[model samples]
Target: MAVLKEKKLGAELRSVLEAAFPGQEARYFLPMSIGNAPEHADEGAALILEGRKTLTSSPLWDYLDGTIPFVGALGVLLDGAGQPRGVVETTCVEIMPFRAVTEDMVRAYGEGERTLEWWQSVIGNLYRTSAIRHGATFTEDTPLIWEWFRVVRRL
Candidate 1:
């Protein structure tokens, strides 16, 4: 189950965090998508390591209290294989609607085309599918948490 995998990942990440930062405390160990399609986890991790992809987005409802990313929060990037590949420090976070996602955000996403049209098409389909599974509705006004981060270390 995803929960069990996440628990295992948490333990592994705790060890990595201890070895990497020694005394520092990590805010979270984010596994891109638990049970859903990985989407761009591998490419995104690679981009982060290369100092290219610095932005990411998630549905606001996904987090408790609609919490957005914090300025110095550290995250461990997990690959499709559920392996830790790198660490990133959040630099900025913005709350916006899906339709308001910018061209810059699309480019930073580092996915195919890097155009707003392309981004919309892809995200729309994804959101629609998710909404169907949850018995919800998808719309352009769907709230999203946009985060910009920088890779601090590669594992």
Candidate 2:
């Protein structure tokens, strides 16, 4: 795999630092977007910034062995256009089966219907689409990377 050795933070991230924490050193991890659609991403980012959304469920297959998110890891959340919007740090991480996700876990996201059924349906659709894109199979027992995060700074 190709790796970038030394690169500066992007313009969006720089602006966020300048606005919220000038001259303070910060290190954020992967670049991630909340949702696939621009409008959906915007809404999710808003909820996150307002402390309304605290949880995210991601497909575990997206990560290789030992590549899963860990507690205290920092990541930059980007908008649909790939512009950084906020920095979030993972406070907890769990690997669980999709069908086994609990209501509490879904409610922790703090958005939409705030119910397990709603979350299952929405996430199921998203994951299903992703599976098709990647030529993979998705099932009720699919493992998921469930992360709980807190906003560090918002742009």
Candidate 3:
């Protein structure tokens, strides 16, 4: 038997957005959650809900060429249990090397020790491991896509 996953989130992409912003339209949206694990996902999503985390970063190499998120991009934030929790709109996007990630940005991540040192050691390791897992190489100078978003609505 096939295992079922992520049942009855009770909202589709369009419905979720519409509920949040009546008459608003988005050309596309990417369903997203914060972490690779259930605990981390819950923690990160909570931060977003609390208005603590407005910034997030991803390896530039993670996106297909020309597919990096642009300003005004819509995303649905999900909790660890795979429940849709909120909608976010990208307000800004910037590129920076991993080592150059600023203190403010890490604070906006609002997780862990919430420091640059913690990010360099902990979040950095996560990024490095992901690169390796994907058969890609990463370095301190690896570019990261830093996105600043606003919580558009809580679902």
The alpha-carbon RMSD values of the candidates against the true structure, listed in the order shown, are: 4.0, 5.5, 5.4
What tens digits encode model 3's per-residue C-alpha lDDT throughout 12-128?
Answer: 766777667666564335666777877777887888889988888888556654476679877778887877888888899899888887788788877778788988898888888
Cα TM-score per model: 0.81, 0.78, 0.85
Which runs in model 3 stand beyond 4 Å of their true positions? Answer: 1-11, 22-24
Question: How many clashing pairs in candidate 3?
Answer: 0
Q: Whose TM-score is greatest here? A: 3
| lDDT accuracy of residue 108 in candidate 2 | 77
Residue 27 of model 2, lDDT score: 43
Roughly what TM-score does model 1 have, to 2 decimal places?
0.81
For candidate 3, give the lDDT of residue 148.
Answer: 86
Candidate order, lDDT descending: 3, 2, 1
Best by lDDT, which number? 3
Quote the positional error of residue 40 for candidate 1 in Å.
4.1
Model 1: per-residue Cα lDDT at residue 73: 69
Query: In model 1, which residue pairs have backbone atoms overlapping below 3 Å?
Result: none
Query: Weakest 10 consecutive residues, lDDT, candidate 2?
Result: 1-10
Instruction: Give residue 113's error in model 3 in angstroms.
Output: 1.1
Higher lDDT: candidate 1 or 3? 3
Q: Going through the candidates in order, what is the number of backbone clashes in each?
A: 0, 0, 0
